[model samples]
Target: MTQQPDTLTESLSLALHYAANGWRVFPLLPGSKRPATPNHRAADCDRTDPWCRTGHAGWEQRATNRPDWITRAWSSNPAYGVGIACGPSRLVVVDLDTHKPGTEIPEPWHRFGITTGADVLDHLAGAHGGTITPTYTVRTVSGGTHLYYTAPDTTRRFTNTAGKIGWLIDTRAHGGYVAAPPTQIGSSSYDVTDDRPPAPLPMFLLDLLSRDQRPTPSTPNDDHNAPQRPSSRPYRPAGCGDPVHSTSAYVEAVIAAETAALNAAPDGGRNLALWVMATNVGKLINRGLITEHAALDRVLAAAAGHIAADAYDTYQAEATIRSGFHRAATKPTTSTRSAA
Candidate 1:
């Protein structure tokens, strides 16, 4: 395997290159995705440094295209990886990750013979009657792909999402970051596979994303063809169904609480709140305690109050729920029944 640079020069050079390309760059910790800069909570900011002179500037705010800043930051730490703030860079990077060892591909995706994030993207593209277009691409150390696209210059700002596009596919846009080429983590390095400038995001993909950001009316189905809740049987207590291998009252209670929280979330933060709730609900699905269809139904019901209140659209909620559930499935967490 190719090793990372032993000195500061290589990192500095790459940082400058990214800046020249107008990407807002920041320093990530050596061998990790976390920011290298000290992130103090706003309440704890003493306003002692230039970064906090006016107010606390987090990684996104501090990310810059300034050559001097990039040089100064990287020069001080040779191992610091470069991070590109996607929002300011006006880039949408589709992250296609490989599956972990010994894990089954999740529903819908596995049913369609999908394996990796790339496969999922290709399948999604085919479903939309299109093919993957050439763009600025990178090969991650883990053998995954990152397809970089230029974000449209409109009011719609895409945010970081897990499985919003499809299984194994995540995106970094507004309020997210990506490790730039030449950044090394342990024995591996992120390398550019394609040097081309980013192509504009495809219209079909844009439409899919736009639907996620808009609000919709409160309804049982988010879209015309969204999967409907199981109507063949009445609701059963947790662990009481034939399909469910096990049961946990704790899981059901968590589902209730999380849904309630999502419903009560304030207008400005409802989307994020919804995503979090969906993710937690997905964890239940991961444990096989609740079926995916049942989980989706609960989330949509909770989000109904918000949709009626004009908080967000149904397509957006559906998109978020699917993404969250798929994320949990792909990255299953260790959960104990007692703690559910």
Candidate 2:
């Protein structure tokens, strides 16, 4: 039968396909966040396992990416939407909601002193000796982002919980589930903004989650999809690695050094400081984060303004930039600063 795209059948078809990828799938009510499992009308439905036939709401027990299980669920209720069981998929979703209380439209994230939770997440990951590389980001039609991360290792499921982690933030883990992208609800749809796969949960973030002992998993599932660890090796110039992979904090460090050196350059420390900028930029170049030629060009461009503002000659600035590059190739820093 020809399937109508973007309809319930299409969503169910997707649930089946996700099952093929080892993502445990369940059905949700059309145009709503509620799971479409049996016995959903019961007051204890939220706490019950929707998937287990032995229990009232065995949704969790029944959740599976297996073709047969998905087939049976959708065959009964084709209108049901896709609910991705988070734990077995080895994914934990960090949901950043933008809606104000009792409102439909989204509120500005900055009102809560948060710009992007993912940005705060990156710094937090780096501070705790974790790698911050590309990961999947979901853009909800409600103008919010869902950051996907690896689930912590445990046999049973982690229950869904919200708000204790941060302002407007919630987690979809073990017993909890998330609406897969393209899952429509009313007029909005969950969509993958960043197509990258999920990154592993950082040890630091895991520590914070450990505090919430509520809703722990009841029975351990036989399936565990431990994701393959991807290496995050930025290019090391010669042998030494770059301290900053062109991160915001690193950029700020370079600017501070350059400004101070230019101010005190009257005593001839200008060359040393300029050299520092070159070394800093060289690291960026080696990592393939920025081009070497572009680095020198920016220095020259910035030098033009500094020269005009400080009333310094063009020769001195250009010479200083060149000298730095020379030193970077000849005498790179032996002991690099901490990556944090």
Candidate 3:
């Protein structure tokens, strides 16, 4: 009888295989996304074990195509999960999750109410042309799949996206990382559905991932017919002989509104307020006062001190801010006139 390979051998071999295939590889905690190395930047672990925590600091830069490094990493501990650095590997992965019965997804995300990874593939084929194809696919533990394809350009910075293209359709691209199969999280594993060579992303899909196809913001509302409210009593539009609608003023208004919302927001409502502020800030970001990243970091820092609810996932917060910011950025820079 043939004996099964030890877990260490299996993990090391898999890591080497990925490196040999030109895919940059790194090790993650056995059952978590945490970097296996003690040097992982985000880890709060004490530096007692120099060897374990001593790598790229985190998955972001830990991936490498070097065979020796991969070997050394796995030889130390074979139970680690294999992570693929997306951009460095020249790959992009579309991650589709199975939505529960009553999630907050957009209405009619799936026109046919389609289900399963296979169904999504079929739908994409017709919608995005023959180019909407995957080079390889991996079945996720959540009944979803990570569809991998080579990127047309590795230089473009792509952020992990959520539900932008459609419902349950997220993307992991540049500046992102993914756990490959054989990386078990408890009793489950990310299993490869196919061993076929990954093909380059179809042009249409590449365009979507490139960030150039982002939706433009609509024209600013004149508020010519807005309902009268108590909030309106304190402020009025710039009267005649006043400066043209100032984006800066508009931005300040947005900040004030958001701060009020943040203070009054109930547990679930704070997240919504954060989302709205990010959108408004995006419209005025061109004023040169702040940046998207800096803005978010500042807000999050404030939340750490002021917010009483559980913090949101970093990616989730970033995605929400990005989507809102991008949409608002496309809007007219001219501020609407206020009636005093």
Candidate 4:
């Protein structure tokens, strides 16, 4: 006769198997109470109640009428759904819910599910490009571990099987699960410790984290050294604000046609360069770094050099004409008498 499997034993066995394999496990519960303040409940508290009529309306709007209301309501009303997170060499037990069935597992944890904590750590090391040492400890409610490893960059996010079933790791929603407070009823706490230090995380994940540390671009034309221009003339950058209409090569060719115009008119060529600079300056102004006047001043300053040279030639030609006119005026009466 074939031996029959026990349902409870199967569940426990499964949980243990994952614990050994490096998968994090969290248990679900029906109802539980959490820590409350002395003034936590009052007539005005109904508005904040997750299951109150008004509160439900807000939840419905945001969650699109999904059954996720159960979790939301639980989060507000009480604490339930306690579980542990175990991975290779590490473990953490907390009060929380795993992702609902059918939720997508993050790419990082897709290949591994419900495995021992050790296996999870190994996979993270070999496949995901990080080595996480297991840290085990005991919480008020349960025993668990923490896996610690340096990430190459912080820009990247991770998702895993626990999150696929509505579980959370470290409260960042990497796996769609959120951490619960330990004080809640039905909520279990966990501990974390590492036998060995974890290796650095993958370069890709590290790169993502590094992006967060970068400074934002500065605003345009705030510099005091910007150029000035004639009082009456309006400042306009040459060849600025051309719309990008199409992806076709023909469109690019048309844009390049402006180069010929620039070659024909030296002033226009200078104007084109000024226009490009002004456009970039405008972008900075929008970001709130430079004042509008400051941007204009910079554009005007760049145009000044070209304008000054042109103006000198123009003034010289005008002066010659004026001198000729003065001489003609002195001799003009004799020519008019002969004609009469």
Q: How accurate locally, in lDDT, is each candidate?
A: 0.73, 0.57, 0.59, 0.33
Q: Distance (Å) between predicted and true CA of 144, model 3? A: 0.3
Q: In candidate 3, which residue ranges exceed 4 Å CA deviation?
A: 1-5, 38-57, 115-125, 213-222, 225-340
Between candidates 1 and 2, the one scoring higher on lDDT is: 1
Residue 48 error for model 4, in Å? 30
Candidate 4 RMSD computed on C-alpha atoms after optimal superposition onto the true structure: 24.9
Give candidate 1's total backbone clashes: 4
* Candidate 4 structure quality by residue, lDDT tens digits, 59-146: 1122111223333433443323333322212322222233346776542334336323333334323322233333322232333333
Segments of candidate 2 deviating more than 4 angstroms: 1-4, 7-9, 41-53, 99-116, 126-131, 154-157, 211-340
TM-scores, each model vs. reference: 0.62, 0.51, 0.56, 0.23
**Model 4 segments more than 4 A misplaced:** 1-7, 24-28, 31-203, 221-239, 243-340
Candidate 1 regions off by >4 Å?
Answer: 1-3, 213-340
Candidate number of the best TM-score: 1
Residue 238 displacement (Å), model 2: 46
**lDDT ranking, best first:** 1, 3, 2, 4
Q: Ten residues in a row with the worst lDDT in model 4?
A: 253-262
